[model samples]
Target: MTTTTPPTHLPPPYAPTDSDSDPDSTFRHIITSMLNSHHHKFGFLIYRVNYDNDALWQNYLNIIDQQTREYVVLEKKEHLLPHIAWTPMEDREKFEGATKDEIREFFRDWIHERSEDRDGPGAGVDNTELIRWSPRYKACMYVNGEMMQGAKMQTVDFLPGGPQLHVQGKGVVVDGQYDEHDRDVLRRSAVGAREDFEEVEGRRGWDVGWMYFTLRGVHMVYETLCMSEEEWTSP
Candidate 1:
């Protein structure tokens, strides 16, 4: 099918803190440029974990999976994901490595597939076999605010070039340790529209900015929303 170019002109790339030789920086700009807006801007990244170079794991089934259990997860550091006992999935194997282009094409096809109708394929898409959590890669989504009690969430103030250091916030130590290098790599594209708490107090405009990160080594993402907040919040 022939597709016409979108009449809407996307904004120029958002700046990154480490653009000189960072693929993540470039990828962040490319994806965020798609969701440009005058009133509000948003960027979401679904990436494999990096920086935590030595955390071990063994279980990946959804029930025992942190992806499912994390919400009910308590503040106990031992109960946190890395220290949990390892178990295997019954029906499917672990998630495999998905490259930047393969994931990009998946979205492209999904877009064209849905453009014909808004109901969105009318059935569940099977990504369970495709993506799984592994020891090497820890899949993480870019959540705008504080997640865990001590997650080193990157803070991007809407400045001209982005923050020199990731906005420093105190986070918890899991299993008696905290990996200060917390950045999510773009295994897939970006997502969502939750209103991030602005750096300016009581002056919340829409969350508009970009964040750069890198890929992890293990398996992750049996099912992910990329945390689609706009769909959840749209009135």
Candidate 2:
């Protein structure tokens, strides 16, 4: 065996900032910085099934299993995600194995489609009726936690699926104004959100956790199966 002696000099230690000193804040800082963009900034509106007792969770997921219903993609935009929920029904039914990007695109396009539905051919259709056909957990995403301002359009209790709220479990918002076109997008989105959750919405359950972290397809049936088993467990 061979051994060597080290040089007499040593390197400097890392100087920590107040933010870095707080481990929780440091983790949060990393996530927020990564999410501060349009493309990489993500959405996270999801049901959190947090419960200790196994039996209660089982009861809850029995309801979740029944929650899958189907809807058509009227604008030819539907793929893995649509409107507020990530599970878009393929042919008014579901298929397995969609990519995360496909679902994110679904969310992005749905935002765009809301504008089209307003002035485009979809105007002939009653927009409110469209919303009435969605799931109990209506959701949306904005740049930060702040909502875009506009003419008052009705909203159901839609949860936000933006990136910041779930990980370290807190978020901060910087508010801004929305012009007419922007406002139209925001308002119409609310109506669609209401339709999804209005009838089915229940007071978010007690045993449920805050959110289900997944690889892709925020609410897609195929993707959700991969969630922590407790999420779909019912008593």
Every candidate's CA RMSD: 21.3, 25.0
Q: Please give each candidate's TM-score.
A: 0.19, 0.19
Worst 10 residues of 1 by lDDT: 171-180
Backbone clashes in each candidate structure, one number apiece?
Answer: 19, 19
> Can you write out model 1's per-residue Cα lDDT over 107-219, one digit (the tens) per residue?
33432332212211111233221112111011222211222122332335675755422322221101101111211111112343234435432333332112222211011
Candidate lDDT values, in order = 0.23, 0.24
Off by over 4 Å in 1: 1-46, 52-64, 67-140, 143-204, 209-235
Off by over 4 Å in 2: 1-125, 135-137, 141-210, 217-235
